[model samples]
Target: MQNPTAATLYSQKQIPIGLKNTIDKTLSEYLKDEKLASYNIDNLKQIIEDSKINFNIKTIKWDEDGSEKSTSAEVASILGMILTFIIYMFIIMYGGMVMQGVMEEKTNRIIEVMISSVKPFDLMMGKIIGIGFVGLTQVFLWGILTTVLVSGSLFFFGGNTSPEDMVAAQMAAQGVNNVAAGSSDISIQVQEIINSINFGMIGTSFVLYFIGGYLLYAALFAAIGSALEQQEDAQQFMTPIMLLMAFSLYAGIYSMNNPDGPLAFWCSMIPFTSPIVMMVRLPFDIPVWELALSFALLFATALLIIWFSAKIYRVGILMYGKKPSIKEMIKWVKYK
Candidate 1:
């Protein structure tokens, strides 16, 4: 028996004990015939005797283990990946502001005067954080806009892109489309993939990796901004960091195309590459150990980069009117 759909706001006194007992009895009667049902008349009897089911809040909260399938995880994972990509692109796209701000200060000769008043490190930190906050504000706006658009699209369109389409594309690419056509095995494969995407893990991991990746890249960008006197001067130094990010992105994408392949496995394990790789793997099955190891490595790497960047930033801010070469960067990196 289904409960009434209408909302009934009942007060604490004069509780509907009789009505509640009748409902419980009905549920017990219905469940008793189903041998598969774990709940029985005894449980219902207790509720009826107690005149309140409130004591079993913990039981009510308990759910079947591993009940969540991979489809939800996959969506969460993809959403995270998309969100991370957008944020990453935005940071890289506008990171020039940090460089430009520094250059502007130097060009106006204001930096020299400011140095008289404040330490170079303080000025550099202030400029980096200030410009970073601006970038963050822009990104926050973009996130809100993107969220609205995606919600609208899914609601209106039912988000029709299904695993079948991806599977078909894969089959067609492999020249197995004709063979997979009208095959029950293809159905099973599709179902397995659908089940493997764990939305919960994907969502959690996406949020973590996205924030972590942004902070990691932003710190590096800030360092680059400090190292260069002008926007143009940043190119030589920025290239390596840019390449690292680009390569990591491509590797993650390529891994998504072949999730179980060696490339995906290796790339996902690498700290620098895991954010993307793990995102792609979220739609598939990844080991717990791999995720843990990747996170540890990335965290350690981020700390090291921050320390190194801060050191370079301290020196580069005061050195003006000269272009920095890779050779000079080696010296900065080597400074004890």
Candidate 2:
């Protein structure tokens, strides 16, 4: 009973079938030995202890200084991915809101009265900017509230160890030493990863991507809304935009796994996909010029989209009951 293996197994409420079989086979083989046939349980325990092998593993991480270093790059990657997805969802949700608002206003003939004073382009820009501000405010509040809640929880519950460590400690207390030990190692690794992140840089990048991504898409959504006479008719125009956004989301996911891959590099540079893809790459060692170029392209593309969408919006806002085809839409762009 004092045998470590036996004691550990006995402590469990239910031994796994495979483990029980292993114990049975090991004891049977030990007893089959002619030298151990007459030995009692205590002597057999000693033999088992003497025959046991212990494996100890140590990991070393090296830095540029030839010294050992621990990094949180994985942690930063995870956080970056989470922020990327959040930004993706925010843009889509807010962009849709803009579209629906425009559709509702046009449906109620409210845009007619408003446009009498405000030019069509001004009205469209105002709607896009106003909704963008609302989205930013919501995200800002959410960030603040999440930070406060996490800080408060940590302050009250002890911030020294992470949640994994707490669970490991509980497991150790309950006699699951092996499980607890494994979890403790994982907890240490997680802490190291968390320590390596640059939250300031990530926060700044997230804000820029979030805004840039939203503006680019919202303009198109507004144009779609204006071109449609009814909310249901917006589907035809919405499909391509939605598909593009979906592709960006998938690209962002792919970039998380291969941040430096060619797919990520090109996608991150592209204006349509840059918002999500660049965010996924930002936590890593991306070059400043590439980031700047992406931003420049995104802003430039947004301006171009707004200019083009404004023309469509100006012509379509007054046209009701007829859903414009692609050819007709192109002609609308040529209108003075």
Whole-model lDDT values for every prediction:
0.62, 0.80
Per-residue lDDT over 1-336 for candidate 1, one digit per residue giving the tens place of the 0 to 100 score? 244233354577775888877766776666644532345555655565578545521111112583332234345456545744764575566555666776677667777788888876567666656766676676567657866875565444323545457455556656545564444344434444343545457656665665455556656776776666666667777788788778877776666557778988787777666666677776555678878887777777766776676677666766776777767865786666
Let me know the TM-score candidate 2 reaches against the reference structure: 0.71
Summarize candidate 2's per-residue lDDT along 239-293 as a digit string, tens digits. Answer: 8888998999899888888899999999998999999888888877578899889
Q: What does the lDDT read for residue 155 in candidate 1?
A: 40
For model 2, what is the error of residue 290's alpha carbon versus the real structure, in angstroms, after optimal superposition?
1.5
- Worst 10-residue lDDT window, candidate 2: 1-10
lDDT accuracy of residue 127 in candidate 1: 67
The C-alpha local distance difference test score for the whole of candidate 1 amounts to: 0.62
Q: Name the top lDDT candidate.
A: 2
> How close is every model to the real structure, measured as TM-score?
0.56, 0.71
